[model samples]
Structures are given as C-alpha cells and as structure tokens.
Target: MLKTILHYINVNRWRLIKISKNNFLIYCSVFVGLMGGLAAVALKYLVHFMEDLSRNIGAHVPFHFMYIFLPALGILLTILYQHLVNRDQIQKGIGTIIFNIKRNKANMKFNNVYSHLITSSLTVGFGGSSGLEAPIVSTGAAIGSVTGRFFKLTTHQKSLLIAAGASAGIAAVFNSPIAGVLFSLEILLGEISIPTFIPLLIASATGVVVAKILYSRQLFHLATEGWHLQALPFYLLLGLLSGWTAIYISNVAHKLEKGIFKKQNRYVRAVLGGLILGVIILIFPPLLGEGYHYLQEVLNGNINVLQEESLFSTWLQHPLIMAGFIAALVFMKVIAAGITLGSGGNGGTFAPTMFTGAFLGLFVAYAVNLTGWVHLNTSNFIAVGMAGALSGVLHAPLTAIFLIAEITGGYILFIPLMIVSAISYIIARLSNSHNMYWHDLIHEKNVRPDKDYEMLTAIEIRKVVNRKYTAVKRNRPIKELYKLMAETSTNIFAVLDDEKHLQGVVLLDELRKRIVDGTLSATATIEDLMIEPPAVIEYNQSAEDVMDLFDTLDVWQLPVVYHGRFVGFVSKSNMLTEYRKVLIGQHHQPDPFGH
Candidate 1:
C-alpha cells in the first residue's frame, strides 16, 4: 500500500506541483528534514525511557553493583541482535556514510533508515558509553538516499538529499539549525554554494521545527555573566589543553577500539570490552551513559555530582582528590566509549567528546581557582571547552562554535569560543592531517580525497574492456591475421600463446604499413608481425591505476591479463567515455519535473 501511494505520487508529481526541479528538491528536503527530526525525537525518547526504567529498577534493587552490569548486558544484547537478526551487516559510524557518498554514488540500503534507530536506542538506552548522534545521522542519510532513489532522482540530487538528512538530524538533535547546516557543509558536503545552501537551510529549519514541536526540552541551559578580557590568557591555555586532549581522546579511543576488536571471538570481545567498560564506569560513575546529566551539573557549578555513585565518593572531599577525579573522568570517558562501540554496541563519539570537554574545562577552572590565581568562571570555560574539544576532535570549527553557542545560549562568550576552538583545531590538525572519520576512511577503507580518483575507482575495469577484439595464437600465419581483421571491425588484435597468455599485440596500422612497404611476408607467423605492448593492465587493476598507465605510456590501448592469461583489450577512448558518463551522471541535473 505504501509503495502504491509512493508510485502514484511519483507518477503525478509534475502534474500535481508544476514546479521547477530546484523547487521540487526543496519540497523533498522538507519531508526529509521532518523524517530526520522525528528520528531524533524517537531516539531521544527511547533512550530517556530506558534510563528512567533502569533508574527505577535500581531504586528497588538492593544490589548497587547491578548498575555496572547494565552496560555489559546492553552490549551483549546489541551483539546478539546484530548476529541473530541483522546478520551482523550493519555498518556503524559517520565515516561509512562519507565513503558511500564518495565511492558509491550516495546510495544506501533501506534497512539503514531504521536499523540504526533500533540498534542505537538499544545500545545507548541500556547505558552503553557512546552517543546516538552518529546513528541518527546514518538513519537520516539513509532516509534521504532512499527518498531520492524512490523518486528516481539524479546522483547529485541524491547526494544533496543525503546531506539534507544529515543536516536535519544534527539540527534537530541540538536544536541548532545553523550548526546543522554547517555540519553538513563542513563534514559531509565539503563545499557548497547558494543552490545547495538554500536546501540545507530549509531542511535544517524544518527539522528544528519538528523537534521543537514534538520534544521541546532545551538540550542545555547556561547562565553566564559574559567573558572578561582578563580571562583571555586562560582561555588560550585551555585551548591548547583542549587540543592536546582532543588528540589524546582520538588516539586512545581509536587504539582501544582496535585492540578490543582484535580478539578472535565476537562474544569474547564483547565480554572483555564490556567488563573493562563497566569497571571504568564503576570507578568514575560520571562516565556512565552519555554523562550529560553530569555535564549539566558541572555547568551549574555542582562539581559534587561526579562523586555521587563513584568509588572515590568519600575521597573526593579533598580539593586535590576532586580535581584528580575530574581529570580521570575526562580521560576515561573516551576509553568507555571506545569499548562500548568496539564491543559490538552501536553509538557515536559526539556526546562523549562534549562530555569529556565539559569535565576538562571544569578541571582547568577548579585547579586554577584552588590556587586563588584570578577567579575564572567555571561555566564560561566549560562552555568554551566544549566547543574547543568538539572543534579539535571533529576538525569542524564552525560547527563546534555555533553548536555550542546555540545549545547553551552563550553567545556572550563567542570570543572565547572562537579563540579556543581555533587553537584546538590548529593543534589537532598539526598532529593529524585528517580528522578521525577521514583518517579511518583513508587508512582502513583505502578511500581517496581526489574526486577524479574516487570516480575512477568506482568504475570497473571490466566494464570498459573491449572483449570483441580478435585473438590469434602466436603460431598463426600472418595471412590469418589479415583475414581476421577483414572479418572483425577491431583495429587491435591480441597474440596469445597456446595457453592463452598474452604474448604481444598486432596493430592494423602497422600491418598496413608493412603491407604497403612490401615488407610483409605471407608465410610470417603472428609473433613476427606482432609488437610488444607498452604496458599490460591486470583485469583486477583499479581504473585510476589504469588511467595513470595510459597517460604514462602514451598508448591508446592496453591488453588485460587475468592470472597471467589474456582477457581483453582496454582502450583509452573507452575509459574516457565511461569516465565522462559518470561525471555527467553526477553533475548533470535533469528536469525530472517537466515544465
């Protein structure tokens, strides 16, 4: 029934709306945004519901240690679900989405639209240490990609809608429309213009509206007396600290994730990772789940919240102990998050980054205040620190700046936010050229940043190979080659051994020249007439490498060999034609909605 309705709408869209392609795209963006916002709302409500349920159960139970087991149980359940139902096929993280957009023409599976919604809710709601933002973005991008496919849109249109969904997801999650648009542009789209910006703006605004109407609670509330010029140097120091901290978090989290998953058995990995994560949470209770409640407490100057359920509760009475506890939370949060995700639990690092940043900021302020060296506003540093850490970790300064400002309503501290975020970003970039997401993609997935290279990578070598070229045994008479050339339209012929291995190539031009110069011998074999090819392309070679060889060798055609056996000939003209088709498909915007 849903399919029939969608088909009807698709068939009559032009007649019903009579709008231009751009305007029609705007309308699609609205729907995508609405769906993205709804996804965010659903995820939030589910996670909160689970948290409340867990809290209620904990209140009634006599075993306080049971809370530590909750994370392990959640991760185990997530792993079970993945294996039993999802077939362990769900791909998590924002890097996967970026790779698909660049290398797969922005196509996504339909199951992704709801798979993340279910898996993330289960993982995060059960007290896993990760965040729901990455899952939400993945769900939203799938919605946009599926929607574009449903309407039979162009590749560019599909990509635009994917970005639109991601923007909406971020906007709705934080209730920050501008930050959402910037997230898409900075992280996903990489570059944008007016036409693209308008759709993203509309989509982000629509998503915010949906989130506000359905789930109206503000994400964070801040009461700041503004920044003081005297705090400039402190903010600068905090910025540098945040940068190094961001590097530490990225590296530690990445290493932990790698180490945990390196185990052979999935269940063993889960049990091991979950136990370690549970122990971390046990020592520093504030590291539980998203830790936003603790972040809020820090923001409100209630540093005491960190000790509520911690093993160090009694020891935190001393100033130095409390500072140490806060510092420990800052570092341990990333470890917990890495364990949660690597153990087969599904979630993102966005919340963990912010959570760590808030605590890091509080630690800096608390330590400085303890010395009585100029009273620094703890709340101001916390807010700026959140932006600084976010900027450094994600390498998205604009997104980090606006998202913090919008969520906290701390525009008064915009200067500090800018200062810290810029410094942190510079430091992080100096340490690692690519952000965490891009770094993983480049090293793990072998994805390249060059557009042409990626496009060529997507093209299959077999698709452009001229299999119609005639092949002759090396012992065949030269007259046989002449007879075959007259029968076939191909100008190139492959000279193969009895075992079908490529020995050499025969060119019609060379053959005609030999014939005209009276140097051709009718009794000569194909080996005598054939010339060695400048290069040979393996059948499984990448199109990028093939193109490089073509340019380097200055040849129009190259023979393809598979397992040392002759396959077919690939031509420069054919490769260029295929490349042009892909370029046109990605760049050309046809009028799907006729005027």
Candidate 2:
C-alpha cells in the first residue's frame, strides 16, 4: 500500500489537477496564473540582480578592458553554470525542454530548469550578449509545471498551469499582458484552446499588473513624439524588409547553433564561444553586454546610425558606415545567440531577436532617408519596423501590434507594425523556420523534421498515435506475456482477445505493480489487470513531438502501427538512449544505437 501510494503521488504530481470538467480546473487556473505572474517578476529581478553586480564591477574596469573581461566573464560563468550547477543544462535551453518531453517521460527536472534561469540571468547581467525574456519564459513555465506537480494535477491541468506561467513571464518582461497571453498560446503551448487560453489570459494579466505595480514604467522605449504619418506607405516597405530580416535571423540562429554544437568537449566549446564574444565586443562595445545600451542608443538616436555619422561617439553621422555596422551587428548577434546556447551560458533567444529586429528596422529607415525622404521621420520608421519584425518573429501579430501602441504610450505604430509582423512571419515560414529557440534546440538533437514544420504548427495525438493495432491473446498467462514483451521490450505491450486484436495494454509499471502485489497467480490471464486500447502511434506519422502526451497517455512507452500490424514501440528510455548514442558518436556503442 505504501509503494502504491508513493507511485500514485509520483505519477500524479506535476500534473494538472481537475476538480471538475469546468469549475474546479478554472479555479486552479487562476491560482496558477497568479503564481506565473509572480514567477515572471522574480525572473526579472534575478536578471537585474546579476546586472547590478556587473555594473558595480564594470565601473572600475577601463572601457576598452571590457572587451576582454566581458567575454572572459561569459566564459567563467558559463563553465561554472554547466559543470557545477546543472549538468543537465545542456541540450540547449529550448532543446532541453523538447528533449525532456520526448525522453524523460515529460518529467521536467525543476532543479535543472531554475539552474538555467539563474545562470542565464548571470550571463546577461555580466555583459553576455544575450536576451532576458527567453530564460524567463522557460523558467516561468518550468516553475509553473513544477508547482503544479505539487498539487497532484491532471495532464490538462498541468498544461494549463504551464501556459499560464509562460504568459505571466512574457507579460512581466514586456509589460504587455495581451502579448504575454499570445506568446503563451503561440510559442510555448502552441494552441489557444479554451482550456489553455483562459488560464493564460489570467496569468498574463496578473503578470502585467505585477510588473506595472513594481516598475510603473514602460518596457520598450519607442521615440515617436513628433513623427509624420504621411509616409505610411514607405513605412510599409520598411516593415516588409524588417519582417524578411526576422526570418533571416531565425535561419541564421538555427544553422549556427547546429554547427557549433558539434564541438566535442564542453570546455573547448565554451572557450571558443568566449573568444567569439571577445572579438565582437572588441570591435563594437555597444554590441557588448545584453544589448540594452545599444538599443537605447538606437532609440535616442544619439550616435550616428549610418555608420558614418559625425564623431565616433557624438560627432557628425556617417550613413554608409552606420549601415554596414548595423548589418554586421545583426549577423554578430545571431552568432552570439548560437554561441550562448552552445556554451550553455543560459539566456533566451527572444532578447537577441528583438535587438536584431531593431537594427534591421534602423537599417531600412536609413536607406529610405538616403533616398531623399528627409522630411520623413526616421525615428517613427524605426519604431514601427522594430515592432513589426518583433511581432513576425514571435508569431504574435496581435500582441505585437498592441504592444507597440502601449509601449509608445498612446502613440500609434499600428499600421506599420501590422505590415512588418505579418510579412516577417510569412518569410520566416517560407524559409521553414520553427520557433528559433525550439528549432535550434531540436536540431541540436539531430531529429530531422519528418514533415514541413508548418504541417506541425500544432499537432494532434491522433496524428502521432494510431488506433489500429495487432496484439497477442490476453488469456495467455505471465509466461506467454513475458515472451511477447521480450520480443518488444518497450514500456507498453498490447494484450488482445483470442482474435489477436487490441484489448488492453500491459504497461511496464502496471506489470510491475501486478508482480509486486502478487494479485495475479501464475495461471491468471492478462485480462486480470490490463489497460484497454492503450494510446497507439501510427506508422508513418510525424511524431507529434510534445511532452504533454507522455502524461496524458500515462505511459512511458507506446506501440507504433503502420497499416494494420504492430511495427514497433517507442519508450521514453528508448528515445533517450537514442539521443545518448548520437551524442556518444564513434566512442561508445550502445546496442540500440550501435551503427
């Protein structure tokens, strides 16, 4: 009984709790949302905590010395975080999430998640060129999932809580509750179902409120106090280009991350990452740190934007040089993103994405102004283009649209924001990029997308698992059951009627339970204790590739069927070993992965 109780608790924890179909879950969602908001607030504070320490230290260091110290700090801190704090922090941040869903039975390791959060915060705080929002989103969702586990949640309940957590995180960071909710649905949860949508909304609202209460200031700084809207069509062109730029960034981030991950030793990989950061910082100090200062300069338009403006710092502006530098910096940021992930220097992809988009916008504005549109407002074009590209990359157009309006405080960049965001999403999709974070991470695991990612924009269990199946007679005793399971040593086994068709599943845990309980005598049949019609994976399917199903199906293993017969089974352990084998390469050869 003690064992049974313990197993029940383990199985049920970190799940969504269902009080009822309607009333109870909704209440739980409210609680989850509030906590999510708090988590976001905490994440922001944590990031600043690191930044404050860096600022104190950096104040003493010479300006040029920052080029050396910044990257060195990135190196030391990264090694410490990976080797000492979270060994499992590897697989990249987004990849870690996806990998856990695939191989770890959808069981998220809370220790590892928060470890990444703090470490990532430190990376950016200490002048690492990365983003704050990505880590926060990942950590917030992880915290929500971990907290939900404590409540004995159901799978649906857990997903709801997780979505709420993500929404809160985004809302808190951007101070845009609507965008937070949209980010949760579009990026993390990948759906806007009633079950997920309502809870996420509450969470985002709570998060935004908390951020507002704490900061009482705007999140993004957009300068458009006295801009003319007569050149709206020109702004549309800017948006179109910016959107295309977002797609380009996404592709670059993915490809580079994959290439960098191939490095054999973690230390060597990290050292290389440090070296790259060093080079970029040396060339352009504005490109150093988390890039907030660089963004501020762009917003303030204090420095020359055209690469050749006035003095180096405050002199006249140089348009040609400014354009070249912006373009170069755009490429540099993508490489930085890849390096951050490769070195395990914990940070989000969103912050870098936003910074790159802003630069891209500025580039377009500069070129347009060069065309003799001097009467047009360069700052206004910059604001709209930035917002639109941000929206497009994030796949949250509505949120992106409204967010700019709010961040700019009643100033309207809506028309240009829509144009850029929509087109950017299209271009990114056209280039076959997934969420940069998720895609880069997935690619790290070397899992080829069987279908175009667009086909998987959202996945259904039916697509991943098949109902049709073949099985053995359940009337057979344990001796026969062992034989069948031996042939297919997966977590789940099919128990059929005399007709050799589906009846129930002999899950490994259930099988172990029966053995320990001694409930079934040697003569007893499989029917005495089997789950009927276990979730099945159809052959030739896209692997739906989500962590949610592991809990919802309540099995660590699943059988795969193609036309009418059982082809194979996929288990959590099986997939993990597969990844492990790939990582091991030519050195080790586990039977499952031995070439």
Candidate 3:
C-alpha cells in the first residue's frame, strides 16, 4: 500500500510539472499564502497560550517579580531544546533566509519550518524581551522552500515561493498586505520584477485576509492627528535620532553576539543572559515579552500606565523623571533585545525595533512639547517614529511607511512618515552600508552582491579547475614532453617532483617553439623546458581573487595548487564560462513564470 501511494505521488508530481509555469505558480501561491497565514495564526495562539500559562503561574507574584525567574527558565528551555532535541544551532533569523537565497540558491533547511515556532514561542511566551515576526518569517520561508522541493520546482520558482511565504507571514502578523509585499521585495529579494510581484501580492493579500478572519483586531489602531508643518523640523530631528538609535541597535546586537556570548558555554551564557534580562525586566516591565501592550499605552498618551506598574511609581510620576525613563527605553531596548537573542532566545528584532521606534517617538514628542517651542501630537509622532526607526533599522523606508499607515487606519501622517523614513534611511546608510540583516551576510561571510564578485562567490575553484591537464616529472626528457604533448589536448602542464610537489610549469607553446627551432635533443630534459609560472592559483582562492590575479599577471592560464600538491590548471576561458553561468542564474534566464 505504501509503495502504491508513493507511485501515485510520483505520477501526480509529473502532472503538476506539466502545468504551465505561471499557472502552477499561481496555484502554489494560494497554498503558500493560506499555509503561511495559518502558521502565523498558530504561532500567535501558542505564544498567547504560553503567556496565559505563565501569567497563571504568576497570579500571586507581582508582574515584575515573576519575570525575575520566568525569562531565565524560558531561555534555559530554549537552549536545552536546541542542544538535546534539535541538536543544531539556532539561526540568525531572517538573515539566514536572505543568505540562503543569495549564496545557497534558495535551498532552505527543513528544520526551520517548525523549529522557530517552538523555540520562539517558549522565549517570548515566558517574557523574553524579543519579537515573533522574525520566527514566523522563517517559518513562512521554510514552508515555501519545502513546497518547492515537494513539487520539484525550478530555482527561480523556489526563490519566488520563499519570498511569497515571507511576505504572507509578515502580512498575517501585521494585517498589512502592502507592507508585506514591499518587505519581501525591498529586503528579501532586492529586485522588483512584475513576474515576482503578482505572486507576492496574492500571497500577502491572502495572509492578511486569513489573519483578519481568525484575529480581527488590527495590530495598531492609532488616532493619528494630522501632522503640523511647524513640526516638520522636529520630525527631521526625530529621523536623525531614530537613525542613530537604529545604529545602536544593530551594532549592539552584533557586538554582543560576537564578543559576549560567542566564547561562553551555551548553557552558561544563556543563564547569565536570562538573569540580566530578568533584572532589566524587574526594573522596566515594559521591555518584557513583545512589549506591544506598552507601545499602545505610550501612543495613547498614557505613558504613566507603566509607571503605575513599577516599583518606583512615586518617583516615576515626576514629569522629567517620566521623560528620562522613556528616553532610557530607547537606548536600553538595544541591550534588552541583543541579550535576549544573543543568549539563545528564539525571537527576532522586529518587535523590538517597533517598540524602540514607538517609545523614541513618544520621548521626542514629549521632550519637544515640554520645551513649549512646538506643539506636536504625541500619537502622530509615535506613528511617524515607528516608520523612522523601521526605515533605519531594517533599511526599508517603503515598508515602514506603508505598515505604519495601514495599521494606523489611514495615511494621515503620510508626509511625516515619508520625511522621517527617508531621512532615517539615508542616515542609516551613512552609518552602515547594509541593514541589520544584510550586514552579517556581507561582513561575516563575504556573500554580498558585486557584479564582478557575486558570480565568483557562487562558484568554487574546484568546479572550474582543469583536472584533465597532466603532470610531467621535472626530469622527463624534452623529447618525451613532445611525445606527451602529442598525447594530450593542449599546451599547459605542471612539472612536479616525484612526490607531486609542483616545481614549475611547462608551456607547450613555448616548448613547440623550441621544437620548431630544432634546438631540442632526445636527451633534453623537461627541467630545461620548464620556467617558473607567473602566478599559481590556489584551489580555494575566490573567483574574484583569481580573476584579479589573471588580469594582474596578464596570463591566459594558471596552474592550480592545493595544499602543496598540483591540482590542475584553470584558464581565463573557464572563469568566463562560470561567470556567464552565474550571470544567467542571476539575471539572463527566461522568466520561469511568463504571462
């Protein structure tokens, strides 16, 4: 029966492939959108369920007091799950997804489909200072990837599916379909082809519809008073502040991961991180979990709601004190999110970015209003600030703008949103070349796109190394070299010692010149015909480096060496062929989904 089922599947798969690419993708998009939406809803339910359970356990304990040990336990459980059950490292959230697209040809790990849901639920549900959007994005991308594999989809189709999944997941979470589509195009795929856009639009719209059906509440329903032109300068200033804050978030998270948590034992690091986070939570309960509730409080001009819940309620009532507290949140949020995720919490920076943006906007508005120089609507500033921080941190201005507009019920603060996002994006670009996600892939792995280098990055030297070239002993007779040339295809040969250590190379063209001159005797040795190669190519050398060497040396071919042994010869021609292949993979191929 199992064999028959397998046979049936194979036959159906063939039929599916026979469908036109565009129609098949349209069909897959609907499935991916529906599934991605369901995954988002399920993740939200699990998180809320865990949160309710944790709350029940802490019913008698003060909210701050309960977090002292809750976040610690959650981190420990997350770490143990990875170590004992999953037995794999937690990934770098959406960065890994983009890396897979660029370097791994969109082939995603199957484990990501469910692992993020498990670990992130545990982390955020139990009060870890993190977000759910990243995990759900990972889950959605994995869904697209596995589905592509199941149908044996083309590489382009697989990539589109992955993008669609990501967009859908984000759309479901925020109930903002346009933002979802923009996020996939701006951040994930980095290209805007019409063929890709249709599927993304369908998936994102479907995801949002599902989210609405299951959980009808919009993420943020801000009554944003229209922005005043007088506040334009202040908005610009807020943009700069948000840009700097974004830099702090990106750098602090990256530094903590590399410097603090990198050397410590995983278990020990997780404990220390959790304990520290708990202390912060005890001091600033708003930083706990997703912090969305606190964000609403701030935007609603009820910043004192958090003060009422704090141990220092009396001290927090002072206007200056309240302002300082809110400002401190903007800076400390970076540390809170960094430590939580750096120490093994399975959550993303998405929620934290929004959290930081909302509070930062509130702080800026409150501070400016206190000065009596400008009258700014606190809610308007909060919405604009969200866009500003998002633009800077995620390097996505359009997404930040549209997401804030849609969630806020309309584009009432459109001008301020555009101003803040544009300025913030520019400032972020000046601070760092790549956004929070792409920077790791570029600086850590050297996988960023460069017209000359991207093709080289995708291919390895072994793929183009000419193993067909033969090696001759340095002592072999020149007359024997003539006999060897007759037997072989072309001119390049490595002259090596008995142990195969490359001594030098013999060019058949040069040897043939000598042969034509009639200056070689039967006893003339290959050593006499050999000369030091201008440059030797290492088998592991990057394609860019190899190409650079070729141009620098003006050589048509270079002998390839690997760990003190002669491997083969690599020619300029082979490099060009590989580069063209890469170019085709990246750009030149006919659209897999044509109209």
Against the true structure, what is each candidate's TM-score?
0.89, 0.69, 0.90
Tens digits of per-residue lDDT, candidate 1, 1-595, equal 9999877677757533666677878999999999999999998998888777667666665544655777777788788888898887787888988988887788998888888888887778777899989999998899999988887677888989999999999999999999999998888878868988998898899999999999999989999989888889989999999999999989987876665757458878877778778777777777788888888888998888777876667889899989988888888889889989888889999999998888888888999999997999999999999999999999999999999999999999899999999999999999998889899889988886677876798689989988776888878778887678769888889888789888899999898899999998768888888889999999999999999999998889999999998889999999999999988878665555563
**Candidate 2 lDDT by residue in tens digits, 31-134:** 65666566666666777787777767767887566565666576568677768766644434555554443333235657744665667777776667777676
Where does candidate 3 stray beyond 4 Å?
4-8, 11-18, 89-92, 258-268, 451-454, 470-489, 508-529, 581-595
- Kindly give the number of clashing pairs for every candidate: 0, 29, 0
Better of 1 and 2 by lDDT: 1
Error of 1 at 150 (Å): 1.8
Q: Tens digits of per-residue lDDT for model 3 on 177-249? A: 9999999999888888899999999999999889889988667778765767788888989999988988888
How high a TM-score does candidate 1 get? 0.89
Give the clashing pairs for model 3: none
Off by over 4 Å in 1: 1-17, 85-89, 258-272, 468-493, 506-531, 587-595
Cα-lDDT of candidate 2: 0.62
Whole-model Cα lDDT of every candidate shown, in order: 0.87, 0.62, 0.85
Best by lDDT: 1
